[model samples]
Target: MSRLKLALFALIFLAACRTVPPPAQPHSGFTAEQQAVLRQIGFQPKGDQWEFGIADRFLFATDESRLMAAQKDSLAHTATALVNVGIVSARVEGHTDNTGTARHNEKLSLERAAAVADALAQGGMQRNRLIVRGLGFRFPVESNATPEGRRENRRVVIIVTPEAVA
Candidate 1:
């Protein structure tokens, strides 16, 4: 009886010590429609945000904030897609290479972000739904020591949040 009681106690203790996985978090950010839109616009998912690289139709000229004709068309398509997906708001973050002074980079980044935001607005997205930010050379995805990396660093990231979709 004593041996049986000890075995039962051990079994109970082992069962109590068994690990249980935590509840799964509900999916956030991009909805199905939004994801479709992102795909259509050629935006790649980078973690929580979406990136439109220079390889896509969203390239910016060297040290320039003006959108090229192709870039404008891309923005238009993106705007239409965003509307279709019911995504009412987005945060546009502009980044640049570390070649320029911090102040200059900041200003240039802001200009680039504003240019993109304006293009989106013209494409039919409401101005109120867009928030522009210039991060300058603060967040570089690659080392700025290489030309390719520098080019990659000069980019605009569109961040979609649950609140934006909601």
Candidate 2:
């Protein structure tokens, strides 16, 4: 995409997100340092997991699977912090809105998760410690009837644990 298109896309996404209410900030059992990392890296800390939404912090263009430059930087920071705080593993889950075929959505979601996991690896987390999954659009945080709700539904939710999950 050209610079103008990219800028316009970001502006449009940001404007669209402005009307949506922010999700509640939920803290998990993570140490203070870990919590701080999550916040600083743009995740809304939820107990046992955190939400990295496409709203305000947009990750990709509609149906676009690659990570934006800023997203990579944020994930890198998160990965470093997770390592420092002794988080052994994470299930990096990718999600999408209900606008595409289930199969395509599932594949896109998985690709997005792998992208996130790759970013984490670049930041210091071991690749083997990360598991990626695509839940598709089946598990939405909001209704799919409206634009704002759909925007909120496009997200990456990470579940961190002390031990690796099979």
TM of each candidate vs. truth: 0.76, 0.69
lDDT of 1 at 99: 90
lDDT of 1 by residue, 1-166 (tens): 9999999999999999999999987564778778777767777676666666446634455587787887878787788787777876778888888997999999988888888888888888897889999999999888989988888888877666656532
Cα lDDT tens digits for candidate 2, 1-166:
6999999999999998887778877646677877676666566655466655344343445687888888888788878877887765788888889998999989988888899889989999888888899989999888989987777777777667534555
Clashes of each: 0, 1
Worst 10 residues of 1 by lDDT: 53-62
Off by over 4 Å in 2: 1-58
Against the true structure, whose lDDT is highest? Answer: 1
Worst 10 residues of 2 by lDDT: 51-60
